[model samples]
Structure formats: structure tokens, C-alpha cells
Target: MKTLTRKEFIEQVGIGAAVLFVAACAGSCKKTAQGPSSVNFTIDVSTGNLATNGGFLVQNGVVVARTSSGSFIAVAATCTHQGGTLNYSSGSNQFVCPLHGAIFSSTGAAVSGPTSTAVQKYNTTLTGNSLRVYS
Candidate 1:
């Protein structure tokens, strides 16, 4: 077997590394091309005086309040299966996506769906009357 020179071996390795890095970077960058980078926005519900089982969508994001229990939960309004916009529906105690009728409960549980994946949920904490959600 012919062994490669040290310089030749290093050159091949470097080229392979560069190719792998570029491939990895390309995959990560593809999602950004569709639009502006994914963004996170905050909702201020401290003053809403919401009733039991009340909920609202903030800047297209959904937050459900278990008013009788004074607890709140935040979930991404985007559907995981098809990326459709989801809305909180009081009639069903769940989030409903209009495009494909995907349903998720307030805790981001998949209630029913054309989808098997549930909505992405945020960490919510009640500081006084304010509900804060984070990654």
C-alpha cells in the first residue's frame, strides 16, 4: 500500500473538515432564508383582569389562564406538524390550528390532531400579576 506524505494527509483532512463544516452550516442557515430569524415576543397580561379559563393570543402567541386556579401557561402558536398558526379555543380548552385542525391542550399536550407532535411550550412564571414566559 502506498502511504500518503504527511503534508498530503493533512491537506486531505483539512479539506474534509472544511466540507463537513460547510455542510453543517448550510443546513442551519437554510431556515433563516425563509424570513427574518425566529423571534420571541412578550405579552403583558398583568392588568387584564381575566376570568377563570380565560386566554388570549399575544402577537400570534397563545397564553391560557386557568383563572379559577390563578395559573397561566404559554405556548407557541405555531403548529409543529405544519407550522400553521394556532389559536386558543375556550370551547374546547385547547389550542386549535385552523389549517389542519391540530389540537393541543394548555400544557402543550397533543389532544387530537392530524399531527403527532405537540406545540412548543414556554416556561411561565407569575410574578405578581405578570406572566413571564421564557425559553
Candidate 2:
């Protein structure tokens, strides 16, 4: 049988620890990037494609949807359940999380989902072509 010397064992342990450290770092780094906890921004609704009804835009991790009635709504793009990116369904007027089928209403209310918590909503102001959304 082969036995490792004390010095050799120490070197192997150090290498193993380094490998484990690198692996952990890589795993943690692969997480989905989250947006700012708080948002404050203004958008020109008149100039961009968002001017039309049912138009939606994602900026700063916020989803701004222009409803069919020509009104603007803003909600956090991240899903409350699992931080999945959200999409607006104009046909249903709801936000859907692609991760786990979580659904939210236009008012950021939790309609149906794995999570009972509602997504964060932002206040919006529309004046002429300028639209402001803030948390």
C-alpha cells in the first residue's frame, strides 16, 4: 500500500480546498442579477414605441406597461416568488413570471402564484409625453 507523507497530504488538502472555493464562487456568481431595490426614473412615452397602447418597456428592472385604455402602469420586473423576470400579457392585462407560472394583476396584486406576496409597484405620473415612475 502507498501512503502519503505529511507534506504531500497538506498540499493535496490545500489544492482540494482551493478547488472547492472556486466551485462555490462560480455557483454563487451564476445567480440571476437583481435590480435596484428602489427605482426612480422618467420616460418619454411619446417618443418611443411605448407610446402605443399595449406597449411595454423594461427599464432599470421595472416593467412599464401601457394598457389598452391608454394608461400607464409600472411594477417590479422581478417576480416575488423566485426573482424571475416578468412579462406583461396585453391580452390578459397581467404580468406573468416565466419561472413558475406566477401571475400578477396590473395593480401589482398577487392574483395567482406560488407566492402570496405581491410584486412591488411604482407610482406613475403622466403629463403630456413625459411619464415618470418612482418607488
Candidate 3:
């Protein structure tokens, strides 16, 4: 059997490391596009996070939020930056991407980015306990 010398082993390790690094970066930086198109859905806001001001929930690829002022907003649930799942911050009335600190307004405009594109926004309406989200 052949055995590698120290120089040969180091070179092999370096090459392997470079390959792994490239793969990791490619996967990590890949933008994830998710959410509904021609969006139309209903959620009962009488319970769960949607029931209260400054609360939120994600359903059917939409992030729905109730602002501190008791109004509702809906936006795509995936971050435009790298497909990170978005979280609604009612305190700031913004959608935030956990992966890269991307900030988006409740209307789905990109406030900051590793992404230049804005997430699509959906229209929201409330009737009794039924909240409808649509494009």
C-alpha cells in the first residue's frame, strides 16, 4: 500500500477543505423562494397569535401579523435574502429574516438586504373573526 508523505497529505487536505467550503457557501447563500402566488386564504383570528395585537403567525407561506395598533398585515413568509423563514416583529412592524438580519417592512418592501428584491405583499381584510389574505 502507498502511504502519503506530510506534504502530500497537507495538499490533499487543503483541496478537500476548499471543495467543502465552496459547497457550503453555495448552499447557504442560495435564495429560497417560497410563498403563495395570487394569494388567497382565510385564517380565524379569534385565537392563537393572531388574536392579539403585536402577535403573528405563519400559514400557507404567509406571515400574518397584528400590529400594536390592532391592524393586520400580511407578507411572504420567506426572506428574499436567502430563503430564511421570516418572523414578524410587531414592535417594529417589520418582518425580519433570522439567517442574515434582513429587515423588511410589513408591506414586504425590503428595508435592507443581502437581497435586492422585495418579497411579495398580500392584501388583508377582517370580517368578524375571519381574516382574509389575498393578492
Candidate 4:
């Protein structure tokens, strides 16, 4: 193999770095381009899993929870305090962030913790066996 001169080596390294930077930027831009927005989806609750009270599921960055009365509620799954992902607690009827211990009520209201801003809530409707969650 032919050895690269000092100047040729620097040029090749610079080109490789530029290519890598462009590739990284392209991948990140694709993610940021899709800003947060309302999402609508249909789920079949006839299976009896989500149909029961206290059932919950997270999909497409949103959390869908079934209340004790069998009512469905949807909200953003990310904590408002530090953008930490939240998990639903069936026993406490709230969403808890493991990162900072932030807690949000079932209605997405910031109940107790460092965050005072409530998470974005979506409206949910049940028609027969179909459940739709939307903004």
C-alpha cells in the first residue's frame, strides 16, 4: 500500500469528518422535524385487557390509562420537569417519573414534585369495542 503524505492524510481525514458530520446532522434533523402534535389511534378493547379498570398502555409517546370507573384517559408520557419518561402507577392512580420522582395525577395535572406544569392531555372516547385517543 502506498503511504499517504502529511498533506494528503490531513485532507482525507477532514473529508471523512465532514461526511460523518453531515450524516449525523441528517439523522438528527429527521427526528426534530416531526414536532410534537396530536396523534389519533384506535385500539380494540374487546380483548378484555385494556377493557378492564386500571389498565394502562403507552404508545407513540402517549400514555392511555383506564380509570377505576372504566373511563379512558390519554396524556403525554414525558415528564414536564426534566423530560423524563413516565410510568403509570395503577395503585396510586398517577404517573411517576423515575428520574426526579415527579408525580402527575391521572388527569395529567402536576400533583407533587419539582414540576408545576401539567403534561399535555388528550381526549379519549370509546365507541363499542373501539377506543380512540386524540388531542
Candidate 5:
């Protein structure tokens, strides 16, 4: 058996801590929607869940929501706090993550939740039956 000197012990501990930190950060290093790079898609609002207010659907990594007042808003579908899937709350006009109760505003700004990072927001334009979501 061998006993480590103070210097050796400190070096080993430091290395171990560095390894742990890297490992911990590796998960966060994954790509976030981060306003996505470029988003341009068309959704049919004449029918389906989008036809009425208080309805939402996820498309191309973005969640398209219709507010209670019949307004359209689009944001990243993933929660910034822990990458959980987000759901639209028409009553609160917010996005919520079921996994950790993280909340985000309709504009994708994290608020009163575990995360402070805001998700991506997309511009939307409605032309009759077609709703175009773009960056």
C-alpha cells in the first residue's frame, strides 16, 4: 500500500473535480433552441387545434400557440431549464414544463421558474388559412 503526499492528494482531487465538472456541463452543452438558427414554416390554421384560441401544437422544434384572444405566438417547444417538453397554458398565457414546473412567457422569456434563459421566439403571419412562422 502507498500513502499519497499532500501535493499528490491535492492534484488527484483537483483532477477528479475537473472531470466531474466537465461531465456535469456536458449535458448543458447540448444545443438549445436558442432562437433556433432559422425558422420558416407554414401551419394551417383554418383547421385542427390552431383553428381556435387556447390551442397549441409543436412543429419543427417550435410551439405555435393561439392566445385566448385569438392571437398567434410561436416559441421554442423545449424548456430552457431542463430541456423538457413545453405545453401552452391559455389561461395564464404562458408556457410550462411538466417535468420541473418551469414557466416561460408567451414571448419565450423564462419567468419565475428554474431557468433564466429565454427560448427562441418566431415571427408569425396569418394569411387566411395559412399561418407562416418565420425567424
Candidate 6:
């Protein structure tokens, strides 16, 4: 067998490294681009009476009262996994993603995986009859 030159060996290794990098990036890029599906409308906050344990979907987010402590919290209704919108479950008092059954607490904590990230939180303040949520 003939001895391989240093330049030839370096060139082969470089080509192999480039192919590995491209394949790795291709797989991860698809995941990063994934997000919640879009909804065409927004929820009217004024109609959301904050009297009891009422929750409402305003625009693409949700405003909910976790307790009688007057603690109102807002979070994105969009799922972090495959871009599914979550519905407010008054019975369970949690956000339920219909797509894959992922659950989240009223405070946006991830109750389950399938989605390893928490729902995006929104800033909220009660403005008279309307709940103002920052975009």
C-alpha cells in the first residue's frame, strides 16, 4: 500500500466534517421552524367578566384566574410543540392542547412534555371592564 500524503488526508477529513454538519443542521432546522398554528381572530376582553374563576381567550392568548386571590394571569394559547392552540378547561382549571393532550397550569407551567417548553406568558392588567394584555 502507498503512503497517503498529509494534504490528501486533511482534505478527506474536511469533506466528511462538512457532510456531517449539513445533515445535523437539516434535522434541527425543521424543529426550530415549527410553531403554533395561527388563529384568524382575537377574543374580546371586555366580554370576559372577571367575577369568579372565569377565563377567556383574547386574540391568540388566554387570561385566567387560578384562584380567588384575584390573581389574573395571561399566557399564549399557542402550543410550543406543534403549533396547536390550547383551550381553557374550566373543569380542570388548566390549558389543554387538543392536538396532543399537552397540559399547562394557569401560570403557564408545563404540566406535561411532548412539549418541553413552557407556554409564553403575557403581561396583564385589569383596565376597567377590559383586561389589557401586552403583545
The TM-scores of all predictions, comma-separated, are: 0.56, 0.69, 0.73, 0.66, 0.74, 0.54
Candidates 4 and 6 compared by lDDT, better number = 4
Better of 1 and 4 by lDDT: 4
44, model 1: CA deviation in Å? 2.6
Candidate 2 lDDT over residue span 2-121, tens digit each: 899999999999999999999989867543323356788999998675889988988998999998888899888988788998899888999999999999899878889797777778
lDDT of 5: 0.90
Alpha-carbon shift of residue 101 in model 6 (angstroms)? 0.4
lDDT of 2 at 10: 100
lDDT of 5 by residue, 1-135 (tens): 899999999999999999999999998865554657689999999899999999999999999999999999999898887788889999999999999998889888888788878899899999988999999
Stretches of candidate 4 off by over 4 Å are 1-35
Question: Model 4: per-residue lDDT, tens digit, 1-135?
Answer: 999999999999999999999998886743221113768898888775587888887788888888777788878888888788878777888888899998988788888999877787887889998999887
Off by over 4 Å in 2: 1-37
- Weakest 10 consecutive residues, lDDT, candidate 6? 33-42
**Candidate 5 wrongly placed segments (more than 4 Å):** 1-33
Per-residue lDDT value at 56 in model 6: 50
Across 36-124, the per-residue lDDT of candidate 6 in tens digits comes to: 23422323344445455555544544434434355566677678888788877766677788999888877677888588677766666
Clashing pairs in 6: 35-83, 36-83, 37-83, 42-59, 43-59
Query: Regarding lDDT, does 1 or 5 come out ahead?
Result: 5
Which candidate should be chosen as best, given TM-score against the real structure? 5
Of candidate 5, the 10-residue stretch with the lowest lDDT total is: 29-38
Tell me how far candidate 4 lies from the true structure as C-alpha RMSD in angstroms: 11.0
Better of 2 and 4 by lDDT: 2
Instruction: Write the residue-wise lDDT of candidate 3 on 9-105 in tens digits.
Output: 9999999999999998986874433467878999999999999999999888889999999999999998876789899987789999999999998
Candidate 6 ranges beyond 4 A from true positions: 1-52, 60-71
